[model samples]
Target: MPVRVVDSSAPSQVSGANPSHTSPPACTLLSVGQAFSGTQNVSSLQKDEAWRVNVRIQGCDLDHGYLCGTMEALNVPMADTPWVIQVVTFWEGEIVDMKNYTFFTGKWEATVGKPFPLMVVLSIVNRSEVDTRHWTKFPSFSPLLSQVEVDGGRSLDLSNYPYIFMRWKEQYFVNVGTDCGLTIAGFYYVCFSCSDGSINGFYYDPNSSPFQKLELKITNEGRSGFSFSSYELQ
Candidate 1:
């Protein structure tokens, strides 16, 4: 999987900001959607440049049946540059929700020490089938550990470190369990399990390096221990 960029000249539109609202007016099935702004390619720029991404979310209105918002991205200087950022909403070190705005930096900015920008417009409508009951169909997996074992038998303590998210596909990543539990660090190593082989999601911490290529799978044994392997980006 590869990192994706949101064009900044225009607004990126995503749907379903808060799906758990139970009010009749705010009742809508949540689905992940994205729209890119009209930003240009920053791959040819020098290391002294980067993009500035801004975000704002209008609180969900129970009376109105609508959720709307906007995000902005601008190319700026690297000296005081706002590098790649992950806007995460959490409480007391436990992550509630997270989103990544890479703005297409993986294509060229990955090695440039600078990242691009993205602007997003979030407009969620009451379109999906209305279900009063909150959906809990996905199985849960926990990856909030201070230490994890890589393929080399070495242990890595990721407490207080930037999160390393594994890309599962274009604009999507393997889910790192959140809201189910709380941890001392805001971030943890990427690890999880799924018997049905159905769960995949996204996570990003701006402090970490640009997105990298990785290979992830479940062994045929099904009950094997958790392990992670990192590959050199080509």
Candidate 2:
């Protein structure tokens, strides 16, 4: 048989979980030279909902040196905006490539980073803005981080500030929020503005139990002043 549907009970090689859901995930393994041309309903963990995405694998074969196929995403959870489906190709438990699709219902050309005969795991991840567990770490320091100076007024070490997991610039981790030093805060950046070469914004004060305001200003010369003010939630 050119193709066989691997059981969902097979041992998992992938790591990481949604954290909010405890239900075991369902997966399918499609090997190179597979003759599959039908659809399979794969359950996905999105917003703690049992969302099913009908995936169709067609004409799967080797193209030039990479695995190529026509993959379609159907019957996805309906939304006001299109859902972003992430296609992840894993080779021997290591991710080789990834792609995204803004899909309500659509088909896309699937290509694996490696060539044929080498079986890979094709995973369909439904990305949601509310799911922070799957959020990726930043490759570098946030742009806002560079403009601010910390206590003792020393410049922040970019090396210690990498990999702050974030979904958007609006919400992120800050390595240094106070004199406490090297503390990770779940605070977020709000109301960022740059006018006449000056920048200002508010960050949740990690030093405070409730919402406190941390004021920062960046001048044209790249010098910034930091101050703290208290406020109560309405």
Candidate number with greatest TM-score: 1
lDDT tens digits by residue: candidate 1, 2-116: 1222211211322222333222211121111111222212232233222333222222232322222232334322224455333222111111111221112122111232222
Report the poorest 10 consecutive residues by lDDT, candidate 1: 127-136
Q: After superposition, how far is residue 14 of candidate 1 from its true place, in Å?
A: 16
Misplaced by over 4 Å in model 1 are 1-46, 60-68, 75-143, 146-234
lDDT of 1 at 192: 20
- C-alpha local distance difference test of each model: 0.21, 0.20
Question: Cα deviation of 79 in candidate 2 (Å)?
Answer: 48
Instruction: List TM-score per model, in order.
Output: 0.19, 0.18
- RMSD after CA superposition, every candidate: 21.6, 25.7
